[model samples]
Target: MKKYFNWANIRLVLIVLLLAFLYAFTTKRNENRKLCNTTVEFQDGEQLFITHEMVNKLLIENKRDVSSIRKVALDLNNLENTINQHEMVEKAEVFVSIDGHLKAVVKQKTPVARIFEGSGSYYVDYKGTRMPLSAIHTARVPLVSGGVDNKNKEDLYELFRMIHDDEFLKKNIIGIQVLPSGSLIMKNRNFNYDINFGKTINMEKKFKNYKAFFQKAVQDSSIYNYRIINLKFTQQVVCTK
Candidate 1:
């Protein structure tokens, strides 16, 4: 028994107990500490949909006084849920740090296309979800008008993705109009004429032809010579004067 309780062994036991006590004390202090500050951040540098003041208001309204004494007493889950429920927020993560700072990171819904039907206007996200127009900031995405509704939001989103990925289309194309027969018409930013896109099918081939035709027309300085450029037929571009 005396050999087991040597000086080295005693020191090792004391160090282990000290570590446990310090850990428990730190945990207790952290749990009892008051909330020092609250900070909000966006995940993808998106500042269009929400403001800092708005996020603070949401926490205060939902958490009912974030100035609560105990850090662990705050309802962080409820706060996260409340912020996530906001129309502009795609997701939110709320947590209290060890330094007693309450932090929330929010991901805003990304607008891929803006749909303008009559007087009604809204945003369509990349996930095919319709979001309300933001009064905070305007997203310079492709505007789609005519024959648009919830049923065709997915199709519009797909088209918007294609336009966004294409460097030439993203810089030039401004608006897309859906016809009654489900055909499409695209308006350019620099041209007075319109592109008669016959159907949504064979989009890759149609866009390829359109790109080639646009290059040749621009090179010839005759792009504006035609009123309407149609890319409906296979491997052919029909121009109307």
Candidate 2:
């Protein structure tokens, strides 16, 4: 019994050593492997502001192609930082697969509204941060003009968020103009009238009143009679012809 137990112990030790050696050899071989290919995937499939080629170009370092680089020399964190530097990219992740291929997963910013200020145009994302216009894709969102700056961006974002959340407003509202006095005027699609939204306060009550008025007007076939629809009042929708 003692001799048999000793033999079993020796076999176990040899097996453990062999497994460790194989693991080390495989790790070393993997480290020496060259980058086989790169894949870029966008989290938001509908909106692609950044192209795969653009991300691949960003992976290049010191005029050296990423494909020519070895796995041991790759810095995934550095690559992710470089990709995140893009104004359109909200977040990016870079990693090497077990097969020696590099992959970048990126999420682009969501533009809620487009701002046309002076001769420059840019996008305001859902997070209320300014994003540069992309040459690759254009988002069909509400156009904003006047009195839109850093100080009032968050307020505008709130207003846009409400509009985006409401299916009726999202479909009908096409433009927004901010007055110098901080009042908002909205332009509706298929209608010549402008909406006088006094201030961002009492927004829910104001939208509710406007919707009630709109539905009534539509039922009566009087939707196109007015020039201005004011929703500043507490419980009433004041209109002007």
Candidate 3:
């Protein structure tokens, strides 16, 4: 019985050593493997700002192509950092798969409005951060001009968010101009009237009043007779002909 127990112990030790050797060998082989392929995926909807080719170009290291590099030579964190630095990229993940493939997953910024300051224009993203205009695709958002600077950008962002969230404002409002006195004037589509939105305060009530007035004006065929629709007052929409 003692001899049989000794034989069982010897077999268990050999099996354990064999498994460890196999694991080490497999790991070493995987480390030495060359990159097989690369895949780039956009998380949200279709990519509008950055292209796949642009992202691939960013993966190039010291003029060396990523696909030509070995798995051992790849710096996954560095690659991720580089892609995240792109103006349109909100976040990115870079990793190497078990099959020796490199992958990059990216999420892009969504532009809520376009701001025209002087001769140049830029986009304000949903997060209220300023983003440079994309040569790839132009977003169909409300245009803003006049008296917009760094100090008042936050206020502008709030106004843009309100407009973006409302279907009527998103469809009909074409442009917004900020006055030197910190007031806002809006331009609508298919109408020659200006919206006198004096300040950004009491926004929900102002919008509600304007909508009610617009519906009534449209029903009575009096929409085109107005030159100005003032919503600066509380609980009222004052119009001028």
Candidate 4:
């Protein structure tokens, strides 16, 4: 009886080992098979997506036999580096799917401010990251001068948000001026209305007050009646000519 019990236990162990070996062998074969399959979703910029165009340019230029375009093993860092080289691309990511499909995602920099460095001009994103202007891109954005820094750039983004969220200011905002202290001054293009929003703060209250005031002030002529709407005080709205 004891000998029979030991034999049964040994048989179970051997069976388990055999199954593990077969599983490993099958996995290796599948991995080897995957290396032969290829697929690419290249963006050629016909859709006007500039970041995709930048990435596709690098890949098409590489002489790495991407014709069959399969088995393309790309390092994520390298993919990011390639897109980062483009002035308009703020960040990028690349990954291959289980079905051997390659996908690249990019975050295009939304140029909020165009700054003059010297002879050349550069763009600043919301985070204040400065990038050079590419001739291919002519995005509508504000031009900032007087040496705006990273912190000023961030402040500008918030100020932009405050104005954009307001129903009146969103369509009317033409451009914003950034002072040395991160203060904001905006102008409307339609009638050249000046708006003084000193140091963007508590946007909810400020916007609400503007809306209420404009309800009466803009009854007839939406422009030329007020030169500037000062939103600096907490309770009073001072209009200037």
Per-model TM values vs. the true structure:
0.86, 0.90, 0.89, 0.67
**lDDT agreement with native, every candidate:** 0.84, 0.87, 0.87, 0.61
Ranked candidates, highest lDDT first:
2, 3, 1, 4
lDDT of 2 by residue, 61-130 (tens): 5445666888998888999999999999999999999888888888998888999989998998878888
* Candidate 1 clash pair list: none
Locate the minimum summed-lDDT window of 10 residues in model 3. 58-67
What CA RMSD would candidate 4 show? 4.7
Model 1, 200-237: lDDT tens per residue?
87888888898999999999989979899998896799
Which is superior by lDDT, 1 or 2? 2
- Residue 89 C-alpha lDDT in model 4: 67
Give one digit per residue, the lDDT tens place, for model 4 in 1-241.
Answer: 3544688889999999999999998666544443222232333332223644456656434545444443434455676687667666666666665555555666676655566656777766656577667656575555545545665556566665554445566666667666666556767656655667677576567667777776767676654677888877858778887
Compare the candidates by TM-score and give the number of the best one. 2
> Tens digits of per-residue lDDT for model 3 on 1-241?
3544688889999999999999999989988888776778999657899998888777656445555777888889999999999999889999888888888989998788898977899999889988999997998898988877788878788889888889998888888988898899999987999999998888888888888998999999999899999999976888999
Backbone clash pairs for candidate 4 read 38-70
lDDT of 1 at 80: 91
User: Which sections of candidate 2 miss by over 4 Å?
Assistant: 1-5, 62-66
lDDT: worst 10-residue window of model 1: 60-69
